[model samples]
Target: MATTNFDCIVVGSGNAGSCAALAAKDSGCSRVLILDKCPPDWVGGNGYFTAGAHRTVHGGLADLLPIVRNVSPGSDLASTIDMDPYTAEDFTGDIMRLGGGRSDPGLVKTLVENSRDAVQWLHDRVRTPFTFSFNRQAYLVDGRQKFWGGMVLSTDNGGKGVIDAHQKALNEAGVEIWFDTPAIEFILEEEAIVGVVARRDGQAVRLAAPAVVLASGGYESSREMRGKYLGPGWERAKVRGTPYNTGDGLALARSVGAKLTGDFAGCHSTCWDFDAAADTGDRLLSNQYTKSGYPLGLMVNSNGLRFVDEGEDFRNYTYAKFGREIMNQPGGCAWQVWDSKTTSWLRDEEYGDGVVRKVWANTLEELAETLAEDGLQDKAQFLDTIHTYNLAVDAFVQQHPTTKWDPAVKDDLSTHSLPLPKSNWALPITSPPFLAVKVTCGITFTFGGLAIDPDTAGVLSEETGKPITGLFCTGELVGGLFYGNYPGGSGLTAGAVFGIKAGREAAKLARRL
Candidate 1:
């Protein structure tokens, strides 16, 4: 086998590994090798699928307080706001609450404190172009309305833009990038990561290094892994992002005594239609709510009954709702119902590359028939449910105003006021065609993986409960840091923060070694 050597070997050139490698080079590491399973064209990993939102305890998070105030001002705004004046402490609390008490509090603190500086470093030192707005929030870019205190992002050139900018900086910093090279396994000795075994050019090569960084991303693409770890129901969910994240690095790390945490991953639930399209190869595209300006309608299970509030954070509730449907409902598929007005609004917004336009039929019966033909739902049951729901909606609308249809407030609207099938029959079942779309839970990225120290970004030992020597992890692999829930814009922020910390700290260790 061919062999090589480096001061540091960073596996997977996505946001975390790329940032780590670049930071290592900047910190004076002489030889840093960054290995990616796919070529640069496919190097984005989950970062590409992101809306490029970055929330911080800095002015950005503070700015959102006003927006929250505008929406619901009467409550204990401070408690609901989840912000503290101490930027670091506030961020730590934010992460801890989101992590559901399983996160490494130390690591959470470190990430929160350094996130702002790390983001700024990427912007100023690396010259990556990012805009701040309400959609973009603090470090976020590409937000639409200014009503919210968010940020915006624009691509530097015609390239994939964000990843390209980071790649350019890495290249300028002289980080050695090996593409189409998958790290098959790690070479560990005496509990320290020594090097990596990779496949490059149809040949196996052993590359020796003092430290190894596993940034290969989470295991969303591996159906087998998901079945084993995320349960059987998850296997049916739609994978909306990179299909290349097969969890190779995690497996390799596990073989070397690394402990796993946060195996329950979360995804953006808005891509529900894509989840149903998994077998058909029809990808679900996002930018729906933001791009289309239409409110997400109610979601019903196989029995044609509404479950949770439609406005719940799409990321947190999508998979949970899916699990509930599979366990409680028949056929294991959910139906999304909307009227002509909502359909027209969404169609004009260009949902899912205009597939929503084609999905919507003229009448409720026709909509059910089309769905049955598409193999998305059962025809007879779906039709019956639609008729029943229409009657309920009509009756409810007659008793209440438009605002009464809101799912956020319950007592404010009577049960009769809720828009059921009876509410308004303007575009009733009598209408030649109605609109229905089959939706399944779609995953964005797996949240759980290896645990790491928040302060140093070092992989923590499961047995000893301490940072592992010469091993660092970042991005999705660092579990417990995010807990069960995610704060908006924290994915990229966490990756950048921990990657920088890991790189700099690893460089310091290398110098001492």
Candidate 2:
């Protein structure tokens, strides 16, 4: 075995790990090394395959002015012209509400309070480019687009943009990044993590460092771990990002007495195109794998039954967990059906040639037949479901007197009586050329991981109920921020926020030790 040494060792090369390494260097750590299991071809981990949206606290356009560039002075700039502002209080409230108050208090507060600062640092220090993502976060309102929810800004070119910026920053900082190197285990000295045994070039090597930051992400890519932690049938869920996030950080930390926390059986999942390859992470097709237009219309299983509330709230509130609902269906699959009235409102992912698996037809009967040909056994039930929903829409409109359904706000249009109901955006399928897209569960990242102190980003030991001396963690590896559900775009924010904290704190610790 070979041995190497560094002041700080950061595992993973995603947004979080890179941010950690950069911060460590900025904090005066002379030697910082980042170990990534992926080769140069697949370096960014899950962050490489994201839209790179970050939910952070901002006063309004004034605060976002520096972060987002190229804002044309017109309402036609997609949906960000009239975007709403979000304060730290708003972000904290969202975390609590979305996580059902189960999120760790300290961790949530750290995320919200430091989000604005972390985002600012990214723009100012890392020089990451950002812009408003109207298609994902905004809705059309009275011909002028409006951004709803707290998340509106994303990397200029999506996840690839973010990774590119981080890699550039790391290079300028002179941080050593070891691609294709995986941290196999931690070297614990008297219960404190001091170094790591890593596998580089197919050989076990020792890397000695006073402090180690683990941002290697979760167990979403491991079929065995998903089956064990996320429960049965999760093995069928499509991997949304890097196949290397196989709980390496979590497993290594837990081996050294770190406590496991967050929703072990839950994860950030979404409606994915069923035709997508099983484990390949295509940077070009990053955003195309998801099918989020289900709120605009209806989703039916093979039995032609609506199982969950399509319009429970906004897509951000429901989209993450809906993939599990699809997986729970009879065949672990569902189809999102939309009429001509709502089809135009869909994002481009649905219509892309190889992006999604879709079926088009002139009428509901034809749509049903097409779905049947695509493996839906109950064609009659499918047609009847559409007819029943349409009739309900007609009755609701006649009695409620809807003038014009505003796309920006949740409309009053709803079903009068149904076993499972659509709570908002209830548009009837009355127009020709209806569309249905086949979808399955797309698991993004596992929610359960190592428990850490929010203030210091230090991993906590379950046995002692105290922080481990030199082990710090961030990214998806740090648990307690999310439980059963999560607000979309908060993951990246949390990762950067804590990663920066971990790096800074670890650097300080290294200097002291």
Candidate 3:
């Protein structure tokens, strides 16, 4: 029985919801409210569990120098950094190539063209502390910071900093955020959404708003939904983000006859720590549970055989889709093998001390014996795999004697004469103190949800294939942008881009009321 009327209401408190709320407030909505289903502890949604990497277009390092707060162009350290400019064509090619050309061309164009401007908005309006990702995206190759994979900028403290910056902006603009409120259904009048009915403080509350934006994330947290949509054995995959994104937005939109789109059977999954919590992501460790070092080494399943070409591309290009490969392997798990040569180069945040459970031995045979206790099936096979792989590397080096191993580029330091080839960064894992870590599939978000108008972010109707009058959507709830695979760091950018469109249109609708 409290005051429930609002000019506009945004659901979910994740990156997209926060952006929508801020944009709505800035677009002339006097009273904007954000409804979050989870408690205050889960404020930032999946953004809190992310590494805060934002991929965008730029004129190389010179274009990015004005936005980043970490390094100064006049400093000596800046002289050693090598960053290439990423054009709109480059961003679009990554998406279309990874998605197998199934991505909506209209949505892809909108996202690619506006990505840099959206990131700039975050830096200027939202006060996001952008910094060059020296620790994650760059490698200290030849004593110079060489950035690869066309991704350079990330938040200063990763996802925590991103959410903190959004929170600060929202608070400054007087946006009302109601936690522990789960939106149950849209209040439809003659098939047009006029408001939403949510559970607030253990009671059903109707919040009257002319425009309602559903940015409440995906159904990755729902094991039932995952099993139903993503096929069998998907329920066993570990969740890498919040547990509250359980298809509430999809269900609400479905009730209003909204069209569902995108790849229901696919999701953004990665090689996570084998010992990580299965139910939800750890707030403290966050994305540190990621095990992406396989590119610099080799991966063998429990059956003691390599399954994927670990160096098929840069980690950013392959990491999101490789988790499904692990799930298909024996026992739905695998172990990455590295020797003393490349173990020192692994990112300290993911493979560092106290971050993951590591198995080490002085010899490959000893490593196999130790890993056998931890689910490895065959010791002889593991050793044979290593021996054969090392021989292939030697053969490749013999053929190309001048080949230099460089992680910053596709140096073609690859292995030949193998059934499945390691295309690049293939070094012999024959050094002392061999290291291995267990890895499993950890899903970040689902790729299926409501279809929306690309220009206004308005949810489309299922029957007539038109925009639903007062309903808008953003974030993971807006489908058609992705299919089987996604480029790294583009998720956050897409959310911000659509969030701006949804907020401006929702604010216009609220004004009409």
Candidate 4:
């Protein structure tokens, strides 16, 4: 009913969309507009629930010191410790390795090469605060702090901080953001993108723009889409973010001949609290529902059988794929069992607020009985599995007497001769007071989305194998970067890199148009 005009239109107000709008404005676009389907209060999309962990390429803390503000005294401590530099080669190798060699080489190259610059842009240009990931990465080693895992930086206050900084940047840049406005379809003139038709205040509003960037997130919140793409039991999976991402971006782009790529059946899913709310995850305690320490202990299905090799890789590499494994388990649930030896090392979210479906007992048998009361049917099988696992751990420890355990690195401690052998961080469960936490699937975002040009982030046409003019996409809506699994913290970095690319390129193209 109403018509609005802008130089660039960005869909979604999450990290990518906000960054796209900012980049558009900064790149000489006079009028850049951002539209979010969610209301004002619930804007920012899925990034609002993230920890703001960014997987970036940097040459030690020196490359980061100038950009990161209000940072802890790390350079002084680094004299004794060696902070290894993560290079583009290392970043690309990790992505390809973690994604099972299925990742698009072009997208991987873009992500690795521009990751540090993207983060630096946020710090210098967007005014986003940065801090070291001391909690997840740093650990005392030989009286010095050692940081591993290739993920060393995060937003000052995690996702909330990133969103707030982006919002502030957008406001200062004079970019217009419209909440409760969902882009329903793209406007094309003879197959060239022009604008969008968005539903605003229950009315179809026409927003005319020469360039449009779609950054709305994936279909994680859509049960119907999940059931369709991710298979039958995925409908029961808990959404780990906003309820706004319901495959609309994917559906809209596909309607106009965009090529869908990546693993449609895969997503960045993880083990969340079984009883987590059906519609959304808690922003305050977002990661609490995420069971990431399964590698340090063990996970058993309802049938009391160990179904997966928990220590196959770091949590970052394997967590995304494990949720699907949990879904396939009996009853679509699993128990993350931990003994007192390793229980204390768990992060605050593991036992903090909103942990309701956990049970503690003085003995393994008692724990099994408690599990029985909570719907675990096979008590004997559970005890037997634990017994076999403990024996394996004891045998391994006896061979390697002086075990060096470090949570930051994959240790030499491993279990052999088990059906699902733990490849690292294996320890005996002899310590009393074992605990178990029930977990179900928490779907973050679907990996399947429209294919895009690697350099420009322009959506590609499947038929022509050419970039769609004036049409760009980023964030979870851009496919081929991730496959069956993803390295943790890479999602945000990719979003920022590609968002900036999409915005700058779209602005340049729009100016010409």
Say which candidate scores most in lDDT. 3
Residues 296-334 of candidate 2: C-alpha lDDT, one tens digit per residue: 889999998877888777788788899999999988999
Query: What value of lDDT does candidate 4 attain over all alpha carbons?
Result: 0.86
Candidate 3 has an lDDT of 0.92
Distance from true position, residue 7, model 1, in Å? 2.2
Candidate 3 residue 97 Cα shift, in angstroms, is 0.4
lDDT for every model?
0.60, 0.86, 0.92, 0.86
Error of 3 at 388 (Å): 0.7
Q: In candidate 3, how many Å is residue 137 off?
A: 1.0
TM-score of each: 0.76, 0.97, 0.99, 0.96
Model 3, C-alpha of 513: deviation from truth (Å)? 2.6
What TM-score does candidate 2 get on C-alpha atoms?
Answer: 0.97
C-alpha RMSD for every candidate: 7.1, 1.7, 1.0, 1.7
Q: Best to worst by TM-score, what's the order?
A: 3, 2, 4, 1
- For candidate 4, what is the TM-score? 0.96
Please provide, for model 1 over 283-308, each residue's C-alpha lDDT reduced to its tens digit, 9 standing for 90 to 100. Answer: 23432322212123445565546554
Quote the positional error of residue 68 for candidate 3 in Å: 0.8
